[model samples]
Target: MSSLAKQLTGVVANTRKLLDLCGSLQAENDMLKLEVQSLKVAVDTSIDKNKQLEEKVKALTVARSLDEVEVGEAGINEKILDTKQKINDFVREIDKCIELLK
Candidate 1:
């Protein structure tokens, strides 16, 4: 019957449209998942960098305190050497970070 055929064609068209939408939801979901992963990585990196900076600040504070306290000239020389060592260590860390960026 003509009516029956028209109804079947309409049903088919509607079904195809629904399937296309469901695929949404699928591609959008995939993209969302990738974005979430990227954001997580960024957050983790930020947290790690913050912790490292906090530790460096603590070390610098201790070093500064040492400068304020004296134990004579010998102690002063030792403090200077220790401070130089700390500076060298910081330079090494900076170089490593630069290498990673490259």
Candidate 2:
């Protein structure tokens, strides 16, 4: 073969290799773009879930505080008064029984 023909053949081979490399790079880029889009959606979903959890926690905290306040303010005082009345009634009954025995 002529020297020029040999050089042309080498150039064609290099061009084909470069074209293959470009095709491979393009495919990889497209795959990466899809992966990025999927990750973004996942992140958005996670953010929404976090917001919902935070709201639930806030509601629960408010409910717990209200429950604590109710117990502190009324429940204990009522129990104590009820117990005092019962004890007074029991003492009166015992006194009546003693008089009857005498």
Misplaced by over 4 Å in model 1 are: 71-102
Q: What local distance difference test score does each model get?
A: 0.88, 0.79
TM-scores across all candidates? 0.66, 0.65
Tens-place lDDT per residue, model 2, 36-96, is 9999999999998997897577556545554555356577676566556655765886698
Global Cα lDDT for candidate 2: 0.79
In model 2, which runs have C-alpha deviations exceeding 4 angstroms?
71-102
Q: What would the C-alpha RMSD of candidate 2 be, to one decimal place? A: 21.6
Across 25-63, the per-residue lDDT of candidate 1 in tens digits comes to: 999999999999999999999999998998789687767
| Global local distance difference test of model 1 | 0.88
Best by lDDT: 1
